[model samples]
Target: MSAARGGLVATLAAVLLVTGAGCGGPDEPGGGTITLPPLPSTERTTAAAPAAAVYRLSGNLCEKADQTPFADLYPREDAKRLVATEKLCMTRRTSAEKSVSLTIDADLLPTEAAAKLFVETGRRLAKRPFTDVDGAGADAYWDGDQDDVKLTSYHGNLVLEVRAAVNVKDGMPDDVVQRLVRVAEGTYAKLAP
Candidate 1:
């Protein structure tokens, strides 16, 4: 072959070699021309799905609840109300002097998914003014309107609702809000822990 033709052939061979090397497969950024082999069946072809976290609460809602937080606030009188549809219980405490009452409702649902959805919906539907609560459960909010204030919390599969009602005619304490916050934190520690 002539010298010019030989030079062109050499350049073409070099380009073909580079292109072939690039076509081996893509794990490279821009991708590759050839398909990769399938991963072994015993080995995970792709990342396995993560397991759902297990959170469970068992037994009586009333008997197992912690109410010592209310010892200073009211006279302890616990209650249990089981409807055909759900498990509901309350610990009602009354302030002897101010005609104040606080009720803690621990409602256990069938699954964590349901309780989470309930709390999510409840938080969205809240129209009254409320404070966002942390460390109580998966999510919680405290709201007060007129004579009644409520703290709704969700943990595991349990939906906890704490309601406080005071008689405005009788009197209201200045530190009631702070005290309720303390009471809520104390109550959640016992229940969730």
Candidate 2:
């Protein structure tokens, strides 16, 4: 072929290649610069579904009760309606040994009753001396002290109490206590009323 003709063909080929890349032509596998559906708004706008509120109460000793009233332990205004209640307790081999108990209450609607019960029970148990034992697991007790107790109420609504140091060999099984707590909490969450 003539030199002029060959040069013309080369120039045309280069132009075509540049045009194809710019336009994301068929030559490109998945087209060009694919833009994602405008990245989800990072702005802290309101959530589509609001998350449920969670509350934690700890280090509440009986001694502090004198300074802080039972009503203050769980403020009425913060209390949410009762969603459910869970009770857990541990038993000892003999009747003489002390038992420990724990309770957790959940609130669905949120109410003052839930908060009152939680604080009242906590104060009542803390004021009483609770014995501590070695092999009790989460809720163990000894003969010397009354027994260890823990109560947890959720959203200031549900109330759960754990009572330990009961007769284990003949009385309720340990597993039953856990099941009761779980069932009660779930039931309260459902809010039958």
Candidate 3:
């Protein structure tokens, strides 16, 4: 494996470890409060809505990839390779020539505060500086370097993220990144308030 890919994998692993560590035992002191860094925002979000009225996953998240819009954005080889869970939809492509993966996460939080905290924490954990993503969502940012791009957005009580990982020899394309962000944003909009 390339040094860059190895380093990226390690960095991502560290991020996951740190994020996972946020959880604590039921009796742990002050563990109920998720320890997240403050977001660089001054405005406050509105009060929480009823759980039934709030943003929640709808339909099959992975099925969106089968649509023409999504199919046209990705390589034909990756067209039908989506695997989705309650909170994530992922597509992977691997051939003798190249290998790449795209994953979209629909982060469902207990409250709007938790969602904002999650998004901000992800931005802080990026290996590279994050650039604000305009026209995507509220306080969106593109994290990670050129080889992989992690587009994150804050919408309602959801922190949507789309991560694209490509081989170092063939860096991720700008168009691909934009299209993936658009897809994620569209999906988020469709599923949330």
Model 2 ranges off by over 4 Å: 1-151, 160-172, 190-193
Steric clash pairs (candidate 3): none
Name the candidate, 2 or 3, with the larger lDDT value: 3
Least lDDT summed over 10 consecutive residues: which range in candidate 2? 61-70
Which of 1 and 3 is the better model by TM-score? Answer: 3
Q: Compared with the true structure, what per-residue lDDT tens digits does model 1 show for residues 1-193?
A: 4555755766677677667867643443223333333323423424595543344455655555555555675654534333211233444455556445666666667677888898768765666645666655666767776678877777666777767676777554555555555655665565653
Where model 1 places Cα greater than 4 Å from the true spot, the runs are 1-60, 75-86, 172-193
Q: Write the per-residue lDDT of candidate 2 for residues 1-193, one digit (tens) a residue.
A: 4555755766777666656557744443333433222323324223474444333333321211111111222222122322222222122222232322222323232554555555444433454433332221212221112232232333333343333233343343334434333433443344322
Q: Against the hidden reference, what TM-scores do the models get?
A: 0.54, 0.26, 0.60
Candidate number that wins on lDDT, 1 or 2 = 1
Error of 3 at 126 (Å): 2.7
Candidates in descending TM-score order: 3, 1, 2
Q: Following a full C-alpha superposition, what root-mean-square deviation does model 2 have from the true structure? A: 24.2
What's the distance in Å from true for residue 119, model 1?
0.9
Identify the leading candidate in terms of TM-score.
3
- Report the C-alpha lDDT of model 3 over 10-70, residue by residue, as the tens digit: 6777676668767754454333344343332222223453443257776566654322333
Best by lDDT: 3
